[model samples]
Every structure is written in structure tokens, then in C-alpha cells.
Target: MLQSLEIELTSNKKQQPAADQLGFGNHFTDHMFIMDYSTDNGWHKPRIQPYQPIVLDPAAKVFHYGQTIFEGLKAYKTDDGRVLLFRPHKNIQRMNRSNERLSVPELNVDVVIEALKQLISVDKDWIPTAPSTSLYIRPFIIATQPQLGVAPSTHYQFIIIMSPVGAYYTEGVNPVKIFVESEYVRSVKGGVGEAKTAGNYAAGLKAQEIAKEKGYSQVLWLDGVHRKYIEEVGSMNVFFKLKGVVHTPALNGSILDGVTRNSIIQLLKHWNIEVIERPITIEELYKASQNGELEEAFGTGTAAVISPIGELNWQDDVLIINDGKTGELSKKLYDTLTGIQMGKLEDPLGWMVEATPVNV
Candidate 1:
């Protein structure tokens, strides 16, 4: 068991927004969890305090060197008023992997999880109760040592904040059009692509912006070297259903090990579906589409859960998938995953971790 965390309630509780208007990442909870680290003291002063701006020196290492990592998860409020966190341990484990890649201090998963439970208990009311809505949790670590000489910082800060959010994409669960990016690459082999760091996302902004301008929802990135192998979507893992089989890009040191991606693979296997993780080139996918073998396409992530891809725009060829409608398998996976997350389905995998009850 971990030590108890200090709680400091806020005097001003922000008014919660209506369920329909609770767009993605617009509103934050009243309290946030924080812990500090140093080379000498390690992690200390775990607490839940009022949500406020953090004060850091302008010359902090994070500002110059970009030594930071983050993880995204959600807290669902069940119909019976119980808060459920899905596969939170997996997210923390990935966070530690990101820390290792970024040269930051590793965190104790158990202690951080305990802190998250305490923080959620204090601000449980912030969790949305509407369908397809939940409290998005963001945990991150940043190097804080003011003197930035390129080496790893001696001081770091770990923080967790909650935001009540709806769908990540404006299209929600509807099928969206994606542009296959050819000019810019998101990551490469032996790079920081697999790590959940800010720089990786920052590097994709240019490609994403170009895709958006061309009337697409997201960019489907290809391999950096060959630029023909399908990698992933802008913020999610990409999957292709061809000839009654599911294929996703292999985690070849470039693709992120997404929690939702892993869960979907597990669920598919449980249903006796053939799921293959290997290098899938865009040419092969286009050939399958031409042969009417490409049945469905979707992207998986915490923010959107499962987003169906209706159209893929690669060069001058446009392949419309499943008649621009959601696929049967996509709908089934979305319903099953969301049902399990919302406490409506039997959790055979035991992925949901219940938060401590809140008195208020």
C-alpha cells in the first residue's frame, strides 16, 4: 500500500457544463494530483490540490530540451454512479516506457494509481454521466531544472489533471475521411515515435494541418524510409479489414503501443478472428480495395475509442470503404468496448478498475 496523499480543496468550484456542450478538453475539474521528483529526494509531496497554472522558470529544461512525456485515459461514470477507469495500469506502464525513452525519472505505478484514485474521489462530481461522455485524465511529467545544458534535468514534476470531454473528433463515431500523407513523416525506426512524448505529436502537426485543409479528418502516416508502408493515423492506431481478416501495422519501433489497439486485438482473438500485425503497404491496401477485399478501416485510441474510416485519399486514387458507412465489425467492436467501459457488459477481461466511493 502507498502512503496517503494530502488533499487541499478549492474554495471556488467551477460550474459544470451541460452534457451536450461538453466538447473535448474544454473544461477541467477543480482539483488535480501532483508529485515532485529530484535526483536526491526522488518522488515526494504527493497531494491533490486546487487546479491552477504551474509556475516554472523560463529556462526550464522542458522549455528548451522538450524533455516531457504524457498519457491519456478516461474515467467513466456508470449508471449506478460508480466511476470506472479502464486499463489504467496499461497507461501508466506506457508512461514509464515514455519516461525511459525521454530520459526522465520512472514513476511508481502503484503509488501514482493510488494518487489518481484519491484525486478522483475528491472530484467525482466532475465525471460526465451522459452517454459517450467521460472525464479525460491526463498524466504527464516535465523536467524542471532551470539550468538547461542539454543533459537530463535533476528535478521533475509529475501531474495529473482531469477534463470532462465528449468525442475527440467532431464526427463522433461516424466514419471519417482520412488523407494518406506522403510529403511528411511522423516518426522513423530507432526514433521517439513509439514514445508518448510531445515532440512526436508536434512533428505531425504540419501533415495534419495539410490534411485538414484538404477536407480530411486526419492524416494516415506512412513509414518514414519507404513512405509506402501504412503506419498509423494522426492520433490513433490504424487497422484494415481485408477479405475477412484484420491487419494492423506491426509495432516495429515506430508505431505506438496503443491501449485501445491492444484491447481490440485481444477482443478479436477472443472471438476467433484472424488478426495479423505486420508491415502493410499502401499499395497492397489499394490493390485489396480494387479487388473488393478491403472491407473496413478504422482507427483506435482513448480519445475516440474507435473511429471508422470511410474514405482513404492516396495520391490521385480515392478508395471509399464500406460504402462510406460504418462496418459491421467496427460497430460491433465499438459497442462492445464502450459497453464494457460503461459497465453495461460483462468484463471478462477485468479491465475496469473501480474508483473509491465519493461521499458527495
Candidate 2:
């Protein structure tokens, strides 16, 4: 039996006219879940309170040293009116992995799931019904100890907030143009690249801006040492198709193992798609594209799912792959993945977990 948790609710009385027009990470819900941690007390003072500005010292470690980690997942409403979450256990395990990398405390999986269930129960109406739209849940930890030292803080705060988001690309499902960064790198061998830390994003922002200015949608980052092998694209794991074989960069220390990436791998195996995880170089991709052997290219992440990449801008040349449109395999993966998420298909893997309801 699940124990009912205490949650103090302060509903947003004045409904904003723009609530239905929520873009990605644009609008937030009414309440948030919060818990504090310390070396002596472990995890304590768990509560669900109204959404408001958080107060923090100017010299907090998170602000100065960037000791922060975050996770992204969603809650969906089925056509039959049942609410479900897709593979939340994966997110919990990933959160623990990130915490270990960032020197934060690990949380129990059941406790975290229960706390999230209680939260979504209160804000269940926030889930959107639009195609590919859902309530995005963000769970993050920040070092709150107010000190200037460059070490990990003894105090931390873990919070989960909900936001209604629409599709990632508003320009339709067209393929993306990626800017290959031969100079700047997203991660290194002995760095915190694999962890979903805040600093990694802050560092990648400049490169992203440059890519945008150059008419590219995202940056295709490469390894730091020789810049010979591919790493990742913006916030996604990339895949390339050559000779009917699906090849993606192996999980080196720099590349993040995305949840969508893992799911795609599993789905490919289910379909008997020859998916290979190995090191891929821009030169090799260029050769394949030039030889007319490159069949398709795409990127996988939780936010965008499987976004097709039609053109690759390597150096001063642009190489177009596929039909300059979303690949057929990309559509299949997207449909199957979103189908399972929206409860439209049989959850063969038992990934969809029902949320506990709140009493009126």
C-alpha cells in the first residue's frame, strides 16, 4: 500500500490566457516538490509547495562552481483518460548516476517515484493533449551552501518542477542542419561530460549560438584530443546509416548516454535493425556521403526524439543526405516510441507506470 503524502496546494487562481500556448520550457505549473539534504541529516524536510522564486546566496556553489545536475522526463494522458509515465525507473537510475558524478547524495528510487506521483496527481490537468505535447518534469539538484570555495558543498537542494511543453521543432518535422565544430569541443576524456551537469550546457551555449548564426540548427560536437571522432549533437546522441547499417558513436567518456538513445537501440534490436555502436569520424561520413552510400542520418534525445538530419556542413562544403526529409526509419521509431508513451500501444516492456491519484 502507498502512503498518502502531505502536499500544501496553492492553485493558480488567475488562469493565464497563454497556458495552452506553452512552448518548450516556457510555462510552468502551479506547484513544485522540494527536499533538502545535508551530511548529518541525510535527506529531510520533503514538501510540495507553491511555485515561487527561490532565494539563494549570491556566492552559492551552484552559482559560482556550477555544481548542478538535472533530469528530464514527461507525464502523458492517454486517449482513454489514463495518466502514465514512460520508464521512470530509467530516469531514477540516471539521476543517481548524475548525482554520483556531481558528488551529490543518492535518493531511493521508490521514494523519489512516490514523491513525483504525488506531485503529478495535484497538477494532472497540466498535461497537454496536442500531438507530441506533454507535461515535462524537471528534477534537479543544486549545491546551496553559501561559500566561495571551489569544492563541493555540504548542503544541497533537490527540486522537481512541472512544465507544459509543445513539440521541440515548431517548423515541422523537417530534417536539421548540423554545424560540425572542428575547433570547440563539448567534453573531454577526464571531464564531467557524461553527467548531465549545468556547466556542460553553459559551455556549449556559445558554440550553439555560433551554429545558429551560421544558419545551422545545432552543433555536432567532436572529441577534444584529435577532433577525429563524433561525440554528440547539442543535447542528443547522433546516428548515421551507411550500407544499411545503423552506426552511432560509442559511449566514450565525453558522450552522454541518452534515454532516447538507449530506447532506440532496444527498438532497433526488436526490429532486427543492424545497429552498431562505434567511433565515427567526420572524414568517414564525408566519404560515405560523397560516395552516395550514406542512406540516412538522425539524432536521438528525450526532447526531440529522433530528429532527422538532412544536410551536414563540414568545413565550407554542405553534404546533403537522405531525401532532405525525415527518414522512413526515423518515422517508425518516432511513432513506436511516442505510441508507447501515449499509451496507444501495448507496453510490452512494462514501461508505463500509472500515477497515484490525489483525493479531492
Candidate 3:
């Protein structure tokens, strides 16, 4: 861990984009936070500096072997000018777990949180206030040793960048069409699918592209082995409401344990709703839809919060959920989750943590 932190503000401030025009991850803030890791010194030299392009050798391990991991969360600007981070500690714990999976050194959670707060404070003005808008925080670590020996790097850089953004999907809280991908497998039981790594997403792009060509917003990936059991919906954890019970795939080392997924499960349990986590086969879901038991479906993630799956195209069989519209439970979950994050509702679970020392 670093002894102290340094700050280097930008000389020229960039003009802010219009709130209505702020798309997801398109506009960045003025500064970023960076820290270095070395075998000899461990993680040190923490600093907040100007947002600029990263400089690394072409032979860096991150380029050759893909040794990197990232975590995403949002900072919401409340009506009272307070900046809040939803379940940031959970994000940190997940990030560290990802670091372990990717063979990267673990991050000091307390120090990282402190740096996050200090960095967000420096660029607090960039926090968007539009509806469904927030400052997206991306914390990433890259192997920087510039070696190509197919081994972990001896040096690394951990950085945090902020993006002022709107909805991740164009549909926002509405329903989306999903194509069940069978041609490609996302990950296996003992793979890096659970980690929030770049490679996992890059591998899913081909399937996503195919789904896009098929008039779908995303692809619902099944397990690698069976190609029958459901795994996830694009980058989000999927949930299906069947016979008045909520069912989601268990995190059996393949599906990511999403922070939003956990929150949704907690919310459902708090409302005395039955939620089952187990291996759910796709055929079973299709059968449920055929029997009029499949009531609704939605996905949970940090970026898209709640994406209602309106249509699922499996083997050319179209399953329209809730008459191809957003379900009441989906809207309620989105509203309740967003409300708690924005301080518009009572936070019974204390999930939202103030990013700054006081209201900004």
C-alpha cells in the first residue's frame, strides 16, 4: 500500500457534454487515479492525474497474454448534491476475487476505496445528474512488465477512470430481444468467466455480433459443456420469474456473481418472494413458457441495472415475455434499486455509501 497520495490537476478543463446527450461511457472526466505494483515494492506511488492515453510497451503482457482485470460501479449525484456509490465494498471484494482468478496481485481494499473517494472528489463536477445517468467508475489493472514469456508480469499498474454516462443499452429500462447463442461457448466451469476480465468480453463479441445480425440486442449464453443450461445474458446475470417464483443460475464457477444480482436477490427475499439459485436448463425454460408459467425475465448488472428480456429466440422459437413489454417487477426493481442509489427512497439496507466526506 502507498504511504500517501499525490494530485496533479489538469491545466485545461474540458467542457461538459449536455446531460441529454450523455451516452454511456462516451464522455470522460478530467482526471484519473493510478498506482503501480512491483515485486520489490508491492503497490505504491498512488496519484490522481490528468486523464490521458496510457503508455505501454508493445510487448506488454497485457497485450500478448491478456493479464488484466476490471471492475465497474457508478457514482450517482443525488438531488441534494450528494455523491453516492452503491455497494462499493461488494465491488471491491469482487474485484479482489477477480484479481486472484487472473493471477494478478490482490488490491488493498481500504486503500483502493480511499483512492476512489479522493479521485471522485477531484472530478465530482463531472458527475451527471440526468435521469438514468451516473458517473461510471472503471477500475482496471494491467500487466506492464513488457515481457512475452507467457508468464505473469513482475510489474503492474492499477488505474481508475471515470465516464459520465447514460443508459448502457438504448432500451434503458425497457425490454430487449435476446438470441440464445449455441454456436459459441462463453466459458467453462473452471474458466475465467466469473472474473470481470477483458478477454471474457472479447470472446463473447462474436456471439454478440451474430445476435445483432439476427435483430437481437444481446445473446443469452448457455453453459459450455451442455449448451443446454443457461448461464448469463450478455454481460448481465439473468433472472426468470416462473410460476410466481424467481429463478437464476447458480454461480457454479462459471456465471459471474454480479453485485446487482445479489442486491436483487436480497430485495426479492426482503419482499418474501421465493428465489431459487440452481442449474436451470434452457429446455425447462422453454417448457415453462409453453405452459404459461414463464411470467417475466430480466438481467441484472452494474451498467444496465435492470434489462427486461422481452423476447428470447431459442432454436427459432420466439418466447415473448409479458407481451413483449417490461414487467411490473422489473420496473419496480429498477426503480427501487435506482431510488436507493440516488437517495430518493429509504435505504433499508444501507447499500449506498457516500463517496465524499460530505454532500458536494
In terms of lDDT, the best-performing candidate is 1
Better of 2 and 3 by TM-score: 3
lDDT of all predictions: 0.94, 0.85, 0.93
Candidate 2: tens digits of C-alpha lDDT, residues 1-360:
124445788955326325447778988888898888888988787788888888998988888888898999889999888889877888888889888988888987788888898889888877787787888899899999999977889899989998888777764467999999887888998899999988899889998999999999999998998888999988899999898889999998888988889888888888898999999999999999889889899998878777889888878788898868888888788889999999998777667899846652
Once model 3 is optimally superposed onto the true structure by TM-score, how far is the C-alpha of residue 147 displaced, in angstroms? Answer: 1.1
Where does model 1 exceed 4 Å of error? 1-4, 358-360
- Provide the lDDT at 115 for model 1: 86
Candidates, ranked, TM-score: 1, 3, 2
Model 2 residue 254 lDDT score = 85
Preferred candidate (TM-score higher): 1 or 2: 1
Which residue pairs collide in model 2, if any? none
Model 1 lDDT at residue 350 = 87
Of candidate 1, the 10-residue stretch with the lowest lDDT total is 1-10
Candidate 3, which segments miss by more than 4 Å at Cα?
1-3, 357-360
